[model samples]
Target: MAVRPDPIPAAQAAGTSLEEELAAVAASSLDQLRPRFRALFRVPVPDCLSRDMVARLIVHRLQEQRLGKLDRSLAEQVDRLGRGQESRRRFKAGTVLVREHDGVMHEVMVVPDGFLWNGGTFASLSIIAKRITGTSWNGPRFFGLRPVLKKHAPEAAVVVDDADA
Candidate 1:
């Protein structure tokens, strides 16, 4: 693998210190300056993203260096939020995830490495989801453990459950 040069080394640029440069970046219009970011980082800023995204990325890095890193729990929470909040309630060893299918409520117990369902340990909820539905599905969504983003509410999911009777 080729060693990549640092994008913006503080030592390379003499006039402005890292703080000063960061301040300028914070104040600059992210949408307007496609060339400036490219010149500084030697990589083009993607046009699809807003300027705030670029500025926030830089600011976050700078603050991270100044303030060290977030706590592990906090970091995990952030990661969870970024990944669509699947299994928000950090499941402990015996926590159970229940979902009703057809007319039966299938119970999945959270284990150390995976989940226990019907006396079997599975690696992922996706495997269980497929087993239950006999079709492909985003496991988190299938279990109603993931937040739905679109206009439709998660409650609107169509379940062909005959057990209501």
Candidate 2:
């Protein structure tokens, strides 16, 4: 976790490199190494980062945030709940839902049960699955794994309309 900040010219101007240190960081999963990484890098997170490598970093951080480290099932459920809320907020209706190259028209409805029911009759639940978990599986596999949603969910639901009010 010790980030030798670009070592002094005398220390390594010849050989030792940041990538080598990153290799050590990579030895432990991101969750196990992020604190060290953060401290060493002195970078504020929650900002745009490059792909895959950053994804691993994020996944690791997420793993660390879960209360029960050994409880994989509970951790997954928590992740789903958190991602669901993020997705709802990020893709609230009128917000474009873009996937790679395709576009899915948005028609979202926040039901009384805290379920975000895709509004259009032909809406694909897969969108919810992919958006929430980065995977697209059939059926309620996504819903079943999600945390038990409450009746009045989305404590910070940003309503784009006033009709409900």
Candidate 3:
């Protein structure tokens, strides 16, 4: 079998800044992008992909290499959304979500384990919502993470007199 060429050039391997590499990718032509795409993705460039798309994929890979990939849970959530599946709202650790109910403002902080509310660490938002509302409620909906579905009204029946008919 023939040997595959290195995806990253020597200049890039030798500590090139992300901006410089991205600029180079942006300036490269289709022919130039093919090998880079193959190297980065470990597969031949698809015939359907445009030069801009290839460049973007390469840029994303490069960024992932330098910065790091998305968190596993976040990536799964994104995939679920992409597949048109329902997914729970995800918040980064230390993010504060706020909602107002009964003229009182309530704040919840996202923690690594779960959520922080009212000086207690809870596993789910629904519990906090229940504490605040005194009734069982979907935590995400109560906190505005999920949309509240509206009930549809029934169609009105028509009444016609025999003479009119």
Candidate 4:
């Protein structure tokens, strides 16, 4: 005669731990670099860099130079320490990128958060992948950015099937 526990709310259960981890990392990094950052730049410290920005930087760098073992090691460190959503989608406009730990969307825009573009253009999964591993992609583009994923065109020549039309 034991009662079953209620299921946790979707929002509560999703990515809360990740948000906390990111907050902790940001706080710790800021604490450690506050003095150096302050001395190095006149601008105020940023609250966070968007995952896209970080990815772009890393991917672009990797493409230009041979990272070898050192980059791989640093990437491993970041992969272990970093916390972020597994996916992202661009909308027509005004999409909320990061939601708060309490489940409210933060008011910050993605561009200021380090996303390279707006206009709600979808990003490629490969670009996102490179970012996570901290390796640069060797592409003609500056940041190793690619177009949004889409269905590949059929290789065979078109066959007319006009039943519906």
Worst 10 residues of 2 by lDDT: 95-104
Which clashing pairs does model 3 show? none
Flag regions of model 4 displaced more than 4 Å: 1-29, 47-165
TM-score against truth, every candidate: 0.43, 0.18, 0.56, 0.15
Candidate 1 C-alpha lDDT tens digits along 1-165: 975433443424667566876776666665434555565457888777687888776666656666688999889888988998653655567766777787778888778889888989998889998999898867777777676676753342233332223
Per residue, candidate 4 scores C-alpha lDDT tens digits across 105-153 of 2222233233332233224423532443356532212222234243642
Query: Pairs clashing in candidate 1?
Result: none
- How many angstroms is residue 52 displaced in model 3 relative to the true structure, after the best TM-score fit? 0.6
Q: What is the C-alpha lDDT of each candidate?
A: 0.68, 0.42, 0.77, 0.35
Candidate 3 C-alpha lDDT tens digits along 79-150: 999999899745677777777777777878878889888899999989998998899987877776665675
> Which is better, 2 or 3, measured by TM-score?
3
Residue 65's C-alpha lDDT in candidate 4? 37
1 or 3, greater by TM-score: 3
Q: Which is the leading candidate under lDDT?
A: 3
- Consecutive 10-residue window with the lowest summed lDDT within model 3: 156-165
Better of 1 and 3 by lDDT: 3
User: Which numbered prediction scores highest in TM-score against the true structure?
Assistant: 3
At residue 79, what lDDT does model 4 achieve?
70
